[model samples]
Target: MGVVINQSIKNTIITYLGFGLGAINTLFLFTRFLSDEYFGLITYILSTANILMPLMAFGVNNTIIKFYSTFRTRQSQNTFLTLILFLPLVIIIPFGTIGYFAFDAISTWIANDNALVKEYVWLIYISAVIFAYFEVFYSWAKVQMQSVFGNFMKEVFHRLATMFLLFLLYLEVITVDELILLIVIMYVIRTCIMMVYAFSVKRPTLKFTKLAKLSDILKYTTLIIVAGSVANIILEIDKFMIGFYNILENVAYYSVAIYIASVVGVPSRAMHQITNPLTAKYLNERDKVSLKELYQKSSLNLFIISGFIYLLIVLNINELYKLIPEQFGSGILVVFLIGLAKLFDNLLGNNNSILFNSDYYRIVLIQGIFLAIISVLLNIYFIPHYGLNGAAYATFISVFLYNIIKVSFVYRKFGILPFSENTLKVSILIFISTMAFYFWDFSFYPIMNIGLKSLIIGLVYGGICYYFNLSEEITKLLNKILKRT
Candidate 1:
């Protein structure tokens, strides 16, 4: 817990910094500097690339995390590492060739409804490939139990680079087309830097020697491709489907709402960087006691943290929208629905890490495939009917059901649940705080109102949580900070 708390706190700060920059870029810069259509196009390109990232990496990112700690000898570990490093080429080369040969058909199909998507379709593939290698290298570092630097690179560096690019766009130093192209180059550069950092952590000694579990590792990697793709599809498919079913600008609007809601999940994302490898280590040692403690503690801490974020977003949503453009205001419901989904995701804690690292991963994979299909079907039926709000509903329902299944399976199999008596207490606290602050708005300007309201909410929420000792970890930290002050 010491290392977990230390790194998670640092990673959380880094992640929030990144999200803050992203909010400025998403809410202000893109809205001010770029036309809505191009903004949507940029969102569409990135979301589409994310959907394709799993295939590009061949699931080697997850493969490294799950398998890296299994080998006892350096020789075998090097062999396994070497295999994963090049495994993506097996998929990448063929995928690239296919894209080259079928570029026209692919672009035409993707751009059927919105012709704007066709011209920049190739950027999606290139970005996906870049994202794939970046995750692989990041995982390489995570296996060494050193994630703060990689987390910084993952969460901060790219957003800062994007900020610079946005500034360049503002100055008319680059055309929108060049801005888009440079975004791809930015990703490529980020990946290269991460690769350098990963190697510096532990330089891979490439070896071709066949290992005993080579077949098993390959099988896990192959199955994980589907699993990883399923997760991404659940997250990004809404944006892609919205692009396909409507104009590009709607995607931009929806992206803003999604980004706002995504802030709730930041704690989970920050914590997972360190928890994932730790989960793998626990499972490798068959330490169910430690694993269960990790699971429950993670759930409680994340819920407390994310619950505050959810309250902040939901309570100030109206004021927040007032700060953004009116067209984006229609996504108020999108924020609530998606924000709730993210909140539940935080409650799952290390559920994903446990399932993915354990032998029960195959079951989770199958369930993910089922939910992915359901997600696509829901979007198909909903988005055309209800617009962006409909997409939000689809995502909320899909993620909600998926989390339930994962939680149930973990409990049934391992006899452990992510909740204790304090879980309900946190929920009640969140509800009370929301009801208390949401309607108690000041008559100031939107920015001032938001700042004042948020400050009050944070102090109130922190005070109550600390007083009740809802989370021992959080309470101790708060007390420590207070003592220092």
Candidate 2:
């Protein structure tokens, strides 16, 4: 728990810092400096790359975490590690070849609605390949239980690079086209840095020795490719479909809303880094008690923290939008819906880790594939009819159903649920806070208004949670902080 909390705290800070830079870039700089079409094009390119990442990496990131601990012998571990290192080539080589041979067809299909996307189609492939290797290396580090630096690279490094590029664009030192190209270059550089750090932590030994359970490892990796792809598809498909069905600018507007909403998930993202490996360790040892405790504690803490973010975003969304361009203001509902969905995601806690690391991962993979299909169908049916809001609806519905399924599956399989009596109390607190703060506002500049309102909400919400002892872990931490102060 100490390790989890320590790393989670550091990871939370790093992730938020990255998100802070992203907010500045997405809301202030990109909106102000770049034209809407180009902004959306950038968003589309990155989203497409994200969608393609799992395929290119061939699920090696997840495969490493799940199997790394299972190998007992050093020789076996070396062989397993070596296998994952080169596994990605299986998909990357073929995908690159296809992209090279069928570039025109691929570009034409992707640029159906937004012709601007054609020029940047290749960047998506390049960035996805970079993103894939970055994850592969990051997972290499994670299996060693050293995730803070990897988390920083994942959350902070590239965003800072993007911030620098955006500033360059603002300074008129780089064209928007150059800014986009440089962003791809930044991803490649980020991957290189992560590779170096991963090796520093645990240098891989190339071994061609036959690994025990090689068949199971290969099977997991193959299934996880679909599982990983399903997760990314559910996340980024809305943006991709938006580009396919509408103009690129719509993708820009949606990106801002999604970014604003995604801040709620930072805690979950941060906690997952350490918890994932721990969850894998516990499952490998068949330590169901420790696993259940982790599941509940993680869920409770994440809900408590993410609940506040959801309130802050939902309550101050109108004012937050005021700071952005008016064209993006239309995404207020997008923010709310997606924010709610992310809050639900946080409530699932280490459920993802539990599922992915467990033997029943194949079942969850199938569920994910079903949900991914539903996400696509919903987007296809809704985006054309409702525009940006339609995309939000599709995402909200898919994620909501997906989380419910995960939570239920975990409970059914493990006889442990992430919820407790305090879960109900925390839910009530969040609802009350929303009602209390949603309509409360001051007449001031949007930035000041946001700051002041967020402060008040934090005070009130934190006070109630602490007073009621909704979360013992958070309460203890808060008391420790107060004493230190």
Task: Note the Cα lDDT for every prediction shown.
Answer: 0.93, 0.93
Model 2 regions more than 4 Å off: none
Task: Give the runs in model 1 whose Cα sits over 4 Å from its true position.
Answer: none
- Per residue, candidate 2 scores C-alpha lDDT tens digits across 89-108 of 99999989999999999999
User: What TM-scores do the predictions have?
Assistant: 0.99, 0.99
Structure candidate 2, residue pairs in collision:
none
Instruction: State the weakest 10-residue window (summed lDDT) of model 2.
Output: 111-120
Q: Between which residue pairs do clashes occur in model 1?
A: none
Q: What is the C-alpha lDDT profile of model 1 across 451-479, one tens digit per residue?
A: 89889899988888898899999988988
Model 2 has an lDDT value of: 0.93
